[model samples]
Target: MFGYSEEQIAAFGLSFGVGAFILYMLFIIGQLAWESKAGKFGTFVMFLGLAFGMVGYLAKYIIRWYLER
Candidate 1:
């Protein structure tokens, strides 16, 4: 396509886009915990809130795989 193969595009999307987002979310969770002095329960809640998008993205992948089959 745009001077890159499908594999190259997919690799960049997963490795850079999704991977960077996950890393940023982890940083956010850690920062929330540290700045707020959140205890274990609070930290868990923060993670669940912040990381839900990532979880949904993964779930979509799984759902698509199953539906395609």
Candidate 2:
């Protein structure tokens, strides 16, 4: 579709699309903290708790790149 192969489209979606979604999720977390009037430490804890999974996901990509090199 649109002159791009399936593999190319899938790669683009996996990379940019998921990345954008992750950022959006972070925004949502921040908004949650703001709306709830979480203090600085509370906000930090919230992010540490909520965004921890994202850290592992990003780390997997980094580890893969390192292993490939």
Candidate 3:
């Protein structure tokens, strides 16, 4: 069990925000000029990683609530 207070929850949000921003800026934005096999594959993987990160972050609390109860 993760024993986190309100401040910790806010920190999670902050960290997630920063990470998501970095992912979008570095990977997502790079796709704008991608036209090769490696670039395309890299872009695809980056998108999946980004999606998973967002989904996991948003679902953490909901999943924890369900499992805890």
lDDT tens per residue, model 2, 1-69: 999999999989988999999999999999999999999999999999999999988998899999999
- Per-residue alpha-carbon lDDT of model 3 for 10-30, expressed as tens digits? 888777876778577656545
Q: Stretches of candidate 2 above 4 Å error?
A: none
Ordered from best to worst lDDT, the candidate numbers read: 2, 1, 3
CA-lDDT, candidates in order: 0.86, 0.96, 0.67
lDDT tens digits, residues 1-69, model 1?
889999999979985799788888799789979899999999999998878778877787789889999
Question: Whole-model lDDT for model 2 versus the true structure?
Answer: 0.96
Q: Rank candidates by TM-score, best first.
A: 2, 1, 3
Model 3 backbone overlap count: 0
Clashes of each: 0, 0, 0
Those runs of model 1 whose alpha carbons end farther than 4 Å from true positions after fitting are: 1-7, 62-69
Instruction: Using lDDT, give the best candidate's number.
Output: 2
Once fitted onto the true fold, the runs of candidate 3 whose alpha carbons sit more than 4 angstroms away are 35-69
Number of the candidate with higher TM-score, 1 or 3:
1
